[model samples]
Target: MAKVKSLDDLKKIKEEFLSKEELQKNGDKSLGIVQIKVAMATCGIASGAKKTMDYLINELDNRAIDAVVTQTGCMGYCYAEPTIEVTLPGKEPVVFGYVDEKRAGDIIEKYIQGGELVGDVIPVNYETIEEHNIE
Candidate 1:
């Protein structure tokens, strides 16, 4: 990490640390807002997931959208390295692949804001433990 030279730099560092902590803690579910989990594994970073994540974070805040964006490990989709899983409150999580900045913007406008499904959706093939238990 770089040394903080000024109060502004220190504040930036603090905010970054807090954001990373929030990512690790998985954000606050009680807020009931849109939750975005970006795949940040090795392959994901190579595929530009970091850019997508930064874009999502900035755009969401700029648009004043209530969303929690977090970094996560591999989603087992190396072919779709820059993938993201979006979960709207009271809805099932949807995983989107090949998510560059433009695609991410579309996802924010169409899916997150308008509740309309966009392209590049990677279907959930496996059952979750909760789903299995419920069945």
Candidate 2:
């Protein structure tokens, strides 16, 4: 890391960081942004969810993609730890399991950027009451 010796350098760094923060904050359906949820439960951490989350955050920013990367608790998929749910604007969320850094990168490139589906998605079998039209 270079030393911040001048105000100009500090301002440049601040600008870059602020832009990323703005993108993360704007990660909502109204903004047509992508929302990413990383499972951070004990099982997930034991399976390397932190690394996967870091990789996604950095990669998303580098790609200049408008997205929010948030850490979440257990997703009830302990069998397949390190799970991530990606929700694109106006679309149902897709959950992927066993995601390492490489898989995370592939997801960002293919699914998020190119709008194509990637392999390794975990099937969501159950549905909420809303889906059954039961109030």
Q: Please report the candidate that would top lDDT against the real structure.
A: 1
For each candidate, C-alpha RMSD in Å?
A: 9.1, 10.5
User: Each model's TM-score?
Assistant: 0.73, 0.73
Report the C-alpha lDDT of model 2 over 1-59, residue by residue, as the tens digit.
89999999999999999887555444464577788999998989999999999999999
Candidate 2 deviant stretches above 4 angstroms:
1-30, 132-135
lDDT string, candidate 1, 1-135, tens digits: 788899999999889988765553454444457879999999999999999999999999999988879899999999876999998866778999999999999999999889999979999899877788743
lDDT, candidates in the order shown: 0.88, 0.87
Q: Which run of 10 residues does model 2 get worst, by summed lDDT?
A: 21-30
Model 1 scores a C-alpha lDDT of: 0.88
Q: How accurate is candidate 2 locally (lDDT)?
A: 0.87
